[model samples]
Target: MIETPGILLTILSFMLVIGPLVFVHEMGHYLAGRIFGIKADAFAIGFGREIAGFTDRRGTRWKFGWLPLGGYVKFAGDMTPASEPSAEWLALPAEERQRTFQSKPVWQRAIVVAAGPVVNFVVAIVILAGFALAYGDVRMPPVIGATVPGSAAALAGLQQGDRVTALGGRSVETFDDMARYARIRAGERTRIDVLRDGRLVSRDVVIGTELQRDRFGNEYRIGRLGIAGGKPIVVRVGLLEAPAVAVKRTGEIVSMMVETLGQVISGRRSVKELGGPLSIAKVSGEQMSLGLDAYVFLIALVSINLGFINLLPVPMLDGGHLLFYAIEAVRRKPVGPDVQEWAYRGGLAAILALMLLVTFNDLGNFGLWKNLAGLIG
Candidate 1:
């Protein structure tokens, strides 16, 4: 059970982590629109009823909303928060049309829509690079430091000081490579190549499976090798190489998320693994407790997730706008308004359903429902 003080810390930490990232995301859209001479009606930090606001000299209403979950920028002539064009947009006079989003060229519109995600990616890269320079890179190699007595490695005749060179005939670059393959291929006999005492040795080992609980209390069945890894080496990154390393790390994260989503879709992974806002809060709290470096890393990781999710080709998302622009470019015209409206409605519903599912999972992870029942008793 968490103390009251701990709960407060979690909420405060969540706000500090999420607020800046979200503001940065919206700032991208605002800056892009302003650059292209488009007028913004409002720049909001959250949805729902406005708590406090003021009109800028340029006539944009800057406000903070009560709900504090997500935010949007209302472009001039937008019908809704989704940026769908309304009768207000179409009814604009020739002179006023110059300041509206719809009046911009298709390429310019695409840039404005894509800017939010792009900014998120940029923020993530910058944070990661800065952290790498500050802390250096501590990475573990594929060397086996010790084996569990009478466990898989012991039964397979694997010894300490052995370096894993390949697994199941596939070249292993790091310990993570071997572990990733082992986790998915559990309960199967696998072939491994090890370099020991300047000699290459081949061995067959049965991957062991175990149930593990994450910090959020979510259970996962992961394959274990019955061997512990050696100490990680700290490699300092130069300023010139930091950005490239950051980019590579971002790409790796994207690839992992894509593969995990693919696995979930293909029934190889569970859907409950998807987290929601509550999970974010829990993780933010945990990372904050760990240290500044850990917290900053979480921010970067979440930023990448935010950017990647927005780039998915789904309606009511930035990627959806890009998709429409692509189609318009190909056909030399915009899609029908009725079709776009319906697509947006459907997309909104889909997003809401996904949110509900992940929130339910989060509740279960925290044992909220179970605790409530106990309290009732």
Candidate 2:
């Protein structure tokens, strides 16, 4: 079992990870709604009971909620208590429905709904770029630092100080390239070109797999070449390069997100890999233990995940609303309320089921169930 400090660290990690991400996501909605001339009823950080609040001149109630899980922005005429109508609202007496959301154009509405995810993506990009610029990208160069004795590299006559020049005839520029090539060829012998003692040499090296574990007891299989590499060399960049770096980082993260989703859908990744609040809390705690930089990185990563997940065309999510907008745009009418309600219910059910499943996985992974079984035994 993890010690008390470890457990506490995990909890703090989740809060740090989820709080800022959720805040930024909700802020996107609030800001977009405001910009599009849609009156916001409330701009909230967190949910449930209001802990702190103040009404703006525009009549938008900005507040912090008691529960810190997530947040929402209530717009005027949103069909629910969450929004007020902009048209009918304005048609009313001067004092009556002054700032309703329904008065906004469809384009405005779409932008308001889309803003939440957009903001999250923007936050992710900024975080990634800022981190990259501040720290300089530390990547493993193709140079080998150490070779494991009696391992595949040793058996293949690969030695320390050898630089990986190419893999499978493809030139390797960085450690990431070499690692990716090796991972794809896991359990298979592959041709590797190395610069050894200033001479280019080719060798057939078989990648071996080993079981790796996290401090939290999570285990996974990783391909190993029994060679260690150096840390990333940080390079400072000017303002001009920052934006490009940010875009590239965002693209890389998006690619990773898509690939991970594909793996999960294809059953190459376990559904047990899905994490819920508990898992997030555990991670948050761990990140807190590692200090601020790691915690910030985790927050950025989770922000990206939240943005990506919400953009999925699943009902009851921001993406689901956007899907409805797309349909409405095509049909020149809004989706019927009955259909929307039913779809929302279905989405809710699916989300709840997923939550339960992920929570169960978290418990099992945390050894809570095992401990319970031991107690009974």
Candidate 3:
């Protein structure tokens, strides 16, 4: 079990990571509204009771809330932070209604809602690009520098300076290709073909195992080939190209998330694999212990995940609002107020259920259930 201080570290790390991201997300919405001349009523970080805050000259209440889980922006015509239309605000005079959010065109309203997630994505892309430009990336040829003594590669007669051509029947063109192929088959038997003295040689061996878990649910077998990689060439990404590289990397992460979700839906993966804030807190602590770089990367990753989740067309989320806007655009009228009310209610129930399930899974991961059982007995 983690000690009390370690637990405190985790809580602090979670706040450090989450607080700024939430601010950026809400700021995105607030700024977008400003761009279209809509006035905001409040700009909040977190939820629930007020912590420390002040009202801005624009009549916007800027405050931090006790609960620090998420945040929102209340626009002029909103009934609540959820952006529900206000009956009283709707009854205001024509001049007073001019700057309200609901008075904006459907397209403008959609942009305001989407700005939150878009800002999250932009933050990730900028951070990743900065890293690539500053630290460079691994892009080298596939050559073995040395094999670990008494290990699988050595036992299989592999030698230093050997160029790997293929692993497990897959072609290996770069060092990254070899690493990617081998990292998934730990402890499994595999064939490796190498180029030595301009001749081809093949060997069969069991890929060594090292279990790696980045988060609560994301695990990798991380096959250890027992051979050191050749000297990695430093490929300093140019400023002009860094953004493209960042975009590609971001796309890959999104693809992985999509694939994982598909697997869960298809029953190839369990619903328990889904994690929540508790799991995030735990992993945030772990990454902080590694180094600032690792923790910063985690922040970027979580930002992207936040963007993707908000883009999902589930009711009560930003995407759900976008979905309603899309329908309004097509039909040339807003969704009926009663229908929206019922839909939001259903959405709230669904979100609550998901949160409960994920929290239960997180507690199980922490062995809380086992601890409770022990005490009960």
Candidate 3, pairs of clashing residues: none
Better model by TM-score: candidate 1 vs candidate 3 = 1
Each prediction's whole-model lDDT (CA): 0.85, 0.76, 0.86
- Please give, for residues 230-330, the per-residue lDDT of candidate 3 as tens digits: 77888889999999878977886786688568757787567887889998998888888878999999999999999999998888899999999999999
Give each model a TM-score.
0.84, 0.78, 0.78
Q: Give the TM-score of candidate 1.
A: 0.84
Highest TM-score scorer: 1
Better of 1 and 2 by lDDT: 1
Model 2 TM-score, all chains together: 0.78
Model 2: per-residue Cα lDDT at residue 61: 89
Worst lDDT 10-window in candidate 2: 81-90
1-377: candidate 1 lDDT, tens digit per residue: 33222787788778878888888888999999999999999999887899999999988999999967557888886566445677777788987878988888889999999999999999999998997898787678899989988777888999989999998898987777777777765566888899999999999888888898755454677777788888878889999988987897788788778867887889767788889999999888888876788888899999999899999988989999899999999989888888888888899999999999999989987888899989999
Candidate 1 least-lDDT 10 residues: 1-10
Cα miss at 88, model 3 (Å)? 1.0
Candidate 2 per-residue C-alpha lDDT over 54-163 given as tens digits, one digit per residue, 9 for 90 to 100 = 99898888888887766777776676522323455556765434345565556777788788889888887788788877876656689988788876678788877899
